[model samples]
Target: MNQPHQPSRRILLKSAAATTAALAVGTAAAPALAAPGDTATAAAAPGGFPDYRYVKTLLKPSQLTYNPTGEIIFPCIRGTAGRLSAPLGRYYLYYAPHDAPGGICLAYGDHIEGPFTEYPRNPLVANVWQPHYSVSHVSSPHVMWNESAKEMWLYFHGENTTTRLARSKDGITFTYDKVVLSTSMLPAGTTETSYARVFPYELPSKNAHFVMLFMLNNTTNHRDIHWGWSADGRNWTFDQKALVSHNDVSAVNIGGPHLLTRGGSAFVVYNKDKTSGGDLMITEVGADFTLRRHLGRFYESAAGAPDNGRSASPSFGTEGGVPYMVYESGERLQGSISVARG
Candidate 1:
């Protein structure tokens, strides 16, 4: 974690940096915006959104093993893991399903990387209402341990125009307790009352009081990721600038933001839809929250997905003290999860 004032005494990186499918692979192949090592994947903007580039391949997709019977399922974007700030320990892997609207999950490991397990009491949904009794309203979850509160939290997107949340004690279980923030609470026309966040992430700077990043649809009618900080995690105020917005070639929907602290800054890894099969992109942001420069495209699909699809969340952290990424791969229709290491 970067302190508010003191700069890290490490590499001055010019600061720019799920799931399985037994499902179907989308139809179109996304343009190779930039090859694996091309730093130009990220374009520079004047003063609004900072320029960003892809880092290296984090977790590329892999199979989700059902510990009990060892059965693998489809669409394993699962859950978001790791703590947003320091003392980052608790890692929650959520299974994408509607069986339990707020059915929370727990996958605890000593280090960021672990052969994590699916705890039996795993699904921790308190009183959450599912879309269908068969479908869980909880999707694209970003779970983390809040140091200040001395507990773990589940921040996720759901049916309502708002994001829902629940708190837990043992990390694995949550009391589907509350609806922390919903779009209905925002002033009218806050970019369509329907825009909702997919995944929730923690910002590195502690100075922001309480900080979090989320995604929403804009007037331009595209999806863009944004941030919010609360003196209290429950009462957050969003940042003025759209943390991330529409791109020139892409229709602009940025979902699943994962933040990693490396070199000296926090590098964000996410996905972009270029009107074709989506490509995963990355970039680095300064301590002041300014976009730095482009990194490059980590990996491009050898094929295209049918729904013009791509998964947003990418995994990043020190696994076995060695950095590795655990992300979902392939297109939904006939895709499965795969893993990669640097």
Candidate 2:
């Protein structure tokens, strides 16, 4: 089912000067300034506000049995399926489907609201990692579960100004690890640096365990939100300014960043894109990321439903305690991969 085309962010604006001179030869180092104090205690588990209004459509693209060019989007969930010396399912649902053979897929469910099951040898991670390089398509996927490397890291993107890293002890075979973030590590008119999301916070004096939130895309194409800091999630360092912009949400740009801690307080739950529609916003992430504060509308686009107005790349989770999200509902390469709960 590969006919509908054009959308890999316009094939990363026609190869962005052919991968910007090999992406400035491994650039990623220049983010040192995390010493202001008081702010580092968000182990994520208070989950107070979540009124995602009971939406549905859990996975579509005609319920893929293995479909590409179908437009499923970035929705990362994991409560298990790592640390696996045996089991392959208890929950784990990373997704993809951007276009042009776009991949990095997987699905399995015991329940996180799912009848999910798709991994009949699915893309797993494609666009050729052959002798160690190849691109044209690979979409946004973000998985995490590295309790000191028991394993499963997997952030993704391909040629949309790069972001990569892979590793897995289980959670289905991956190993490519490197090129942790690109667009020459951001800023100089940036130009597309994929949608990422990684968390395990602890920074202010540094020895940073890990923290990343992405989506850049400048040179006038707008789009904001940026950050990086990793002691060892596979070497990363980037902060060339912008932890959320479009002047901090007057909105025409802002992107799909999700790092919602709630109750230990640390937020950056994004997606604002507005000519008049797209919502899901919230800010308040202080200390060292340099304090931002734009808390407004955490979900909006219900009127006609099916998110035709836009609700983008989100991915929050909680189960026995309830809260849930997992978004990207419609428009933007024509979407679907929904779920809301509170």
Return the lDDT, model 1, position 99. Answer: 28
Which tens-of-lDDT digit does each residue in 24-72 have in candidate 2?
A: 2211111111123422221111222434553467788777877857677
Give the alpha carbon lDDT tens digit for every residue of 1-342 in model 1: 111112212111122221111011110011112222334322322211122222222122233322322211111222223322332233444434322343333443343334555554544553244542233344545555555665666675555355666676655555565555655554444552222222233444643554565556645666666666655667666665566655622535655555544334545555665454466555566545676554545444334331124433454433222223445544442333333333
The list of candidate 1 runs beyond 4 A from truth reads 1-92, 98-103, 106-117, 126-136, 185-209, 218-221, 248-251, 274-277, 292-294, 302-311, 333-337
lDDT of 1 at 223: 66
Per-prediction backbone clash count:
48, 0
